[model samples]
Target: MSPCTLLLIACLGVACPTLAGCDISMERQGKYKTEAPAPLFADGTSAQTPPDDTVAQGALAEEQAAQTPPPATPALLARGRERHDIFCKPCHGVSGEGDGMIVSRGFPRPPSYQDPHVRQATAAHLFDVITHGSGVMFPYAERIPAQDRWAIVAYIRALETTHDLDISGRPSPRTAGGRGS
Candidate 1:
């Protein structure tokens, strides 16, 4: 072989082994495979169970609040009105008639709270809708807290009740109070 060819072969012989030892590939890592037996752990499993009563951060309190609704009070109604104006009014309208400015601007109108089906829906149903959303409406869960959602339900109930009353504040003829005994 030529001198240059012999010198190149000698250099490659020394460098190749050094380069091979420098491998840092993640695929060749020493991590335990999922669900595989872990001899180092007492449980002998790769996955470790969370301790008893361990709730995910920020989840326990919100979950509890979501389960039980607070009683409706004037303060709650006022907070509801403020929250409603900020979050709901744009789509649901000032009177819960589903004719907000967005509708005038060509957005789809939401169902009116005064609709018979909506009026008959339980407060829990409303809360769920607000949390998870329905139809074209997006969820407000991330934007509105659980307590505020309950307050909005109370405000909607008040709106439905007021809508059922006549201009003189008496029950309308369609209601039980105005129906013949």
Candidate 2:
């Protein structure tokens, strides 16, 4: 072959192997496939269940707090009122008749705490609703802490118990007034 042809063959011989080695695909990376045997662990499984009783970081306290509600003390009710005013009043209204300012401005009215269904709901149910939300409401799990959610539930329960009755134990005008008449 001519010198030019020999030089081209030499260059190609050197380049082809180098170019082939340039594969940076993810398939070549060190990783365990799902359910594939992983020699790294003693059990030889790629997916390992957490060791028994392993609580996720920061989850132990959260789980405990979420499971137990604090007593309905005045301080808790006050905090709940404050939090409710900030987070719920806009949509649920000051009295929670679902006449909140946002509803007046055209947002859908949330259910009234005075509703029979709501009054019959357990405190846990209300807490779940606040945390997970229902209907058009968005979840407040990230925004409201668990304690605050429990406090809100307490305040809602208070609202349910007292919304209809005045200090003298008579139905308030809000309920017994011209509402139905």
Q: Against the true structure, what is each candidate's TM-score?
A: 0.65, 0.64
Best by TM-score: 1
Tens-place lDDT per residue, model 2, 22-96, is 979997899999999999999999999998988889788887899999999999999999999999999998988
* lDDT of model 2, residue 163: 74
Candidate 1 stretches with Cα past 4 Å from truth are: 1-54, 172-181
Relative to the true structure, candidate 2 reaches a TM of: 0.64
RMSD values for the candidates in order, in angstroms, are 11.1, 10.6
* Count of residue pairs whose backbone atoms collide, per candidate: 0, 0
Badly placed stretches (over 4 Å) of model 2 are 1-56, 167-169, 173-181
Q: What is the lDDT of residue 82 in candidate 1?
A: 88
Candidate 2: give the clashing pairs: none
